[model samples]
Every structure is written in C-alpha cells, then in structure tokens.
Target: MITLQLAWRNLWRHRRRTWLTASAIAFATTLLVFMITLQLGAYDMMIDTSLRVFTGQLQVQRQGYHAKPQMRATVPDAQALAARLRAASGLDGVAARAQGFALASSVSRSYGVPVIGVEPEFEARVSTLPHLIKQGRYLSSDQAQEAVLGAALARNLKLQIGDELTLLGSGKDGSIAATIVPVVGIFESGNPELDRHLVQLPLKTFQEVFTMGDDAHAIVVSGPSHEAIPQTQATVAAQLAPGSGLVVLDWEQLIPGLRQLIQADMVQNWITYIALILIVTLSIMNTFLMSVLERTREFGIMLALGSSPWRIGVIVLLESVYLTLLGLGIGLLLGGGIAVYLHYEGFTFPGMAEIYAQFGLPGVIHPKLSFAGFTLGPAVIFVFTVLAALYPALRIRKLQPVEAIHAV
Candidate 1:
C-alpha cells in the first residue's frame, strides 16, 4: 500500500509530462478503435449485400457445374435435394434455380442476357429479389410465359410493363427455339453486371422452354444465421444419397473473389495497427528513460533509507499502470462518442460513392462496435506501457546509492 502511494505520487509529480504521454496513448487507442470498427463494418456490409443479392449462405450443385456453368450441367435430383436442405435444422429456406445465357429482343433492339428461372415462393424466402422490384409487380406463382427484366436491360431494349419480348436460346437438344414472354417487372440492383444481364422467369417456364424438367443448375440455401452455415451444410450433405454426385459449397467458396478482398483489407489493417503500437511504444520508452535519468539522486536517497530494488521496480511498474489506465479510460469515452455519432449519421464519400455504386456498394458506411473493441484496446495499451517501463526499471537496479546520490 505504501509503495503504491509512493508510485501514485511520483506519477503526478510531473503532471504535464505524464498527461502528455497518457494523451498520446489515448489518442492512439481512439484511432485504432474507430478505424478497425469502420473496416470491419464495411466488410460485414459487403458480405451481407452479396449474400442477399445473389448467393445465399450455401449452395449445392452438380459436381462439375461450378467449373462449367451451363444449362445442361444441372443437378438431376434437384427437387429431392432442395427438400432435404429445406428440412435441415438451422436452415431458413432452400430454393432451386436454373441459369443460362439467352438472347432477349424487342423489335427495336436485341441483347444477350443471363436468365434465371426460380420458384417464386422459395426464391422470396432465400433472396431479396421480391423486395427489389422497382416497377410493376413481381412474377406471380401462377403466371406462365412471364419474365422480369433488370433496369439497365429494360432501358436498352426500350421495354415496359406488359411488353412482349422474344427470348431465343438453344433447348436441351441444342435446337434453337424462341418464346414470347410478357415483362412483368423491372429491378435495379445497383450492380451494373447484374442489372445489365439478369432476367428472371418462373421455373416451370424454363423447364418447358429448356426441356429439362425437374433439373436445376443449383440449390441455394439460407441459414438462420451466418454462424450456423457450416453446421446446416453438414446436415444437408449427410441427407444426400451416397452417389448423388453433388458438391456443397459455402458462401466463402462460392464467392472467392469477395472473400479474398476482405482478407486483404484485414491484413492491411493489422499492419497499420502494428505500426501505430510500435510508434507509441518507442515514445513511452524514451519518456520513461528520461524520467529515470532525472530522478537518479532521489532513487539513491530512497535506497539509502532502506528502499529495496524490488520496491523501486514495483513503483515504476505501478506508475506505468496508473497512466495506462487513465489513458484507456479517456480513450474509450472519446472513441465511443465518435462511433455512436457515426453509427447514426453514417459517413459519405462524395466522388467515391459513384465508383462504389458501380460495384453495387452503398454510399453511406456505418460504424460498428463490439466487445473486443471495448476491452482489447485498453488491454493492449496497458501491455505496451508495462513493456516500455522494463528498461527504466532495470536501470534503477544497477544504480549504486552513494555514486547516484553524489553525482547530480
């Protein structure tokens, strides 16, 4: 208790210097928390948007379908697999879809586009397409020879609600056939590639047109939560027959490009965080060394009065702990205040917004807070402080009392 009091007093003896060091640590902590929160939040948003817009938590496809996605490479037991996946625990919904490239044309214009055939109710349970309709209405479950066009595709073809468009493509026998489909709706996803290429129609319509009844290119499954994806995938995989010749892929594997991008960002953030910690550590070490040099005579006097080297070391460590704790407290308050403000208002980058919009990313970014941010920031600061004090404490043990006392 006595040693603690002495240490506390020593920390406050030079209030300005101690406060400066503490403020530096606090500022570092605040920046780290804010930056990391923003990075993680952006990553989370990207994954969520991608999942909602296209891929679900997991997908099951024929063994070689992913490598060469074509109308012919569809799962033969798609209906049975979808039923098994839908029945699995931790799964929210499962839907089967067939995808292919086709030429869509009006009398005035013609363009090649990607077509997706889906079961309306099952698709609504798994994806956000139902909510993304911008004009007219989504395709009804009973609607036959109906199609939905993306905004860009509609504009290019000069199409509107109730317009009849001719879709020409090769059927299962590789013979070219054409069907007239009434456009039911137009959707805009803010993704140029998707918006310009995608068109949706009823699964039955596709089956009749492509001559592939009860077959699908893939079965998309949504889990109750992201954390449950792996477990749900396992359950669904186990339900499949031994020779079904299907492969189940998780979101990360299905979207390797997006996963790689997130990983790269995380790596960059870690490097920046390490650099900041090193800078702060160096600054604190220099300050502690200077303090020990200035207080040599005082330390010698205390030693002469029966203060042990161990007590001197404890005092230095205690001083570091006190400053670190104070800094951490201030840092958490400041960082929390900023994060709360940003979480509500969001941050917008003007010119960058358009660039990101082209890639289907939102203009505004929200900050996120987690238990790790609240706890780990202070813990790291405290560890850095203790480490910085080690050299100065060792210097105190090497001092001879008489020489140290008389030198200055």
Candidate 2:
C-alpha cells in the first residue's frame, strides 16, 4: 500500500511528462478501437451487398454442383423443398432457381448467355436484381412467358421490350430445349460482367422449355443480415431429410474471390495497426527512461534509509502500470462513446452511394463494437508498455546508494 502511494505521488511530481505519455497511449487506444470497428463494419456491409445483388447469403445445391455445373446436376423437387424449408427455417427468404446456358437470339443477332428462371415473389425478397430494372417491369408471375435481360445483352442482340427472344439449350434429361418469349424488362447492373451475359425468365416457362420439371439448379436463401447467416444456414440444413443429395453454401463458398478480397483488406489494416503500436511503445520507453534518470537521487536516498533495491524497482514498475491503466480507461470511454454514436446514427457521404453503384455497396458505414474490438488494441498496448518500463525499472536495482546520492 505504501509503495503504491509513493508511486502514485511520484507520478504527480512530474505532471506534465506523466500526462504527455498517458495521452499518447490514450490516443493510440482510441484510434485502434475506432479503426477496427470501422473495418469490421465495412466488411460486413461489403459482403452482404455483393451477395444480395445475385447470390443471396446462402444457397442449397446438389453435392459437387458448384465445382462443375451440368444440366443433369440439379436439386430434385427443388420448388417443394424450398417451400418446406421456408416454412420451417427462421430465415428471411428462400427461393428456387434454374440456370442454364443457351444461345439467345433476336431478329438480327445471336449470342450465348446464361438463362436463369426465378420465382417472382420470393426473388423480390431475396435478391436485389429485381430492383435494378431500368426499363419495363420485373416478371409478374411464375407462369408468365416473358423475360428480363441486361441492357448490354439486349443491345448486343438488338432487342427492346416487347421484342421476341429465342432460346435454344439442352434439357436436364438430354433433350433439346427451345423456347421463344417476349422481352419485358431490361436492367443495368453497372458491372459489365453481369450486364453483358445474363437473362431471366419465369420459372414455370423455363422449367417447360428446359424440361427440368420442378427441379432447379440451386435454392437461394437469405437472412436479415450477414451476422445471422450461420444460424440461418444451420436451421435450413437441419430440416433436410437424411441422405438428401443437397448441401448449403454460405457467401464465402459461393464467392471465393470475395473472400480473398476481404482477407487482402484485413492484411492492410493490420499493417497500420502494427506501426501505431510500435510508435506508442517507443514513446513509453522514452518517458520511463527520462523519469528514472531525473529521480536517481531520490531513489538513492530511499535505498540508504533501509529500503531494498528491489522495492525501489517495484515502485517504478507500479508507476508504469498506473499510467497505462489511466490511459486505457480514458481511451475506452472516449472511443467507445463515439463508436456507439456512429453505430446507431451511421456515417454517410454525399456521393458514396453513386460511387459504390458499380459494385452494389452501401454508402453508410456503421462502427460496430465487440469484445474483440475493445480488448485487442488496449491489451496489446498494456503488454508493450510493461516491456517498455522494464529497462528503467532494472536501472534502479543496479544503483549504488552512496555514489548516486553524492554524485549529482
């Protein structure tokens, strides 16, 4: 208790230096807390926005279907399965889709494209594609003999709404699939990859034209948010019958490229965080070294008055501990308060939505607070601060009482 009091008093003895060192630690902690929170929040938004554009948060497909797609590789009775799963699973939406490659033709031009059949009602709930339409309207019924296509695809084929489009492909049972439908809608996704090669048809017409019956290539599903995906996926999987040749894939499995993108961004953030910690560690070491040098005479007098050398060293260590704790407390208070405010209110930019339109990302970014976000940065600072104080504390142990007291 007496040693702690002595250490605390000595901190106030050099108030300016003590406050300066503490402020450095506090600023680092606050910056780390907020920065990590922003990264986590941004990642969540990026993933969900991308997935919602076409690939929902999760998908149910036949085993090995994703590695190599074949017309024959399909989820049997997919529509019924989707209905059952939707009623039982606590998920936001579930829908079935049939996909195939076909040669799409207008009166003058022809091109190969992916033809996807979707449920209008459920698709509106699970996908943002329906909302991207720039001309005409989305499919009105599962039975409508109409199609929606990308603007670029329509342009490539010299098509416009109400124009006839002929589709020719192979059926799931190896039969020839052919159909002609009128184009009813056109969408511009802003991504050339999607804009140039995709078309959509009513599920019922597609099933007949492709001879797929009620089977579908994939079952698309979504949850309220990315964080709920794991639980939502588990609920759907549990309801599947034993020996069902079906598997559920989350966003990561559905898009390996997106996973790689997030990892690359995380590595960049870690680099910045590491550099900040190193700077704070050096500042702490400098502060403790100065304190030890200026207080050498006081330490020597205490040693001569029957205080052990180890006791004087311990006081120095305690002083470092107190300063670190004080900084940590203030940082947590300020940073956490600001983060909480942003989390609820959100931070936005005037032109960010337009900028992100090309990739389907959100404009507003909310800072998220979690146990890891709050503890990881401050914990690293505390460990480094203790290490920084070690050399100065050890100097007190090597002091000669008579020489230290009489020299200066």
lDDT of 1 by residue, 86-130 (tens): 776545479888887789998799998878888887887777766
Q: What are the per-model C-alpha RMSD values against the true structure?
A: 4.1, 2.4
Off by over 4 Å in 1: 1-9, 90-92, 173-177, 267-279, 299-318, 333-371, 379-387, 390-403
Q: Rate the local accuracy (lDDT) of all candidates.
A: 0.81, 0.88
Question: What lDDT, from 0 to 1, does candidate 2 have?
Answer: 0.88
On TM-score, the leading prediction is 2
> What 10-residue stretch in candidate 2 is worst by lDDT?
354-363
Q: How many angstroms is residue 381 displaced in model 2 relative to the true structure, after the best TM-score fit?
A: 2.6
